[model samples]
Target: MWVVAQAPPETPVGPEFGKASPVGLFILVVLGVVILGIGYAFHRRLSRFNRRRLFAEQHGIDPFDREAIDAAMEEAGLRDLSRTSYL
Candidate 1:
């Protein structure tokens, strides 16, 4: 009697597999945008803090004093536009 060897079946490639859908791509893009936005906000806050610290050092004031920093910024006319109203 003779025995025969059989080969394994190959996996079929289709649109549903091994491909990113439009909705998935959109979600990824949205997540990336959100992360970037958060990073930008953090950077802006850090820069503002640094600037306030430098200003405080220049004027011989405590950098951690919120009131002093605000007063210095206000006295220098360097207030953020978002906090001021022009009516």
Candidate 2:
């Protein structure tokens, strides 16, 4: 009885066997787009961080000093690119 209820081995047995649906393909494409977007955002944020760190280091300011960094960024006509608001 248990053998009778067991699944088929090595071969699929279904109505739409070996066929991929359009909806599944669409979900995969959407997931790819989402991953690309996240990667882009990460790269952008990292670039901004590097710029900010360089700026702070050049001017002898502490990298962790948010208030000073904000003031310097403002003085240089630069926006807070490291913030998620830019994304």
Task: Indicate which candidate wins on lDDT.
Answer: 2
Clashes of 2: 0
- Pairs with steric clashes in candidate 1: none
How high is each candidate's TM-score? 0.69, 0.74
For all candidates in order, the CA lDDT equals 0.78, 0.86
Q: What's the C-alpha lDDT at position 15 in model 1?
A: 72
lDDT for model 1 comes to 0.78
- Tell me the tens digit of each residue's lDDT in model 2 across 1-87: 355566667777789899998999999999999999999988887898889999999888999898999899889888776765744
Candidate 2: C-alpha lDDT? 0.86
lDDT of 1 by residue, 1-87 (tens): 998877658775687878867999899999999999889877777777787888889999998988877887889888743244322
Superposed on all Cα atoms, model 1 deviates from the true structure by an RMSD in Å of 7.6
- Residue ranges of candidate 1 with Cα displaced over 4 Å: 1-15, 80-87
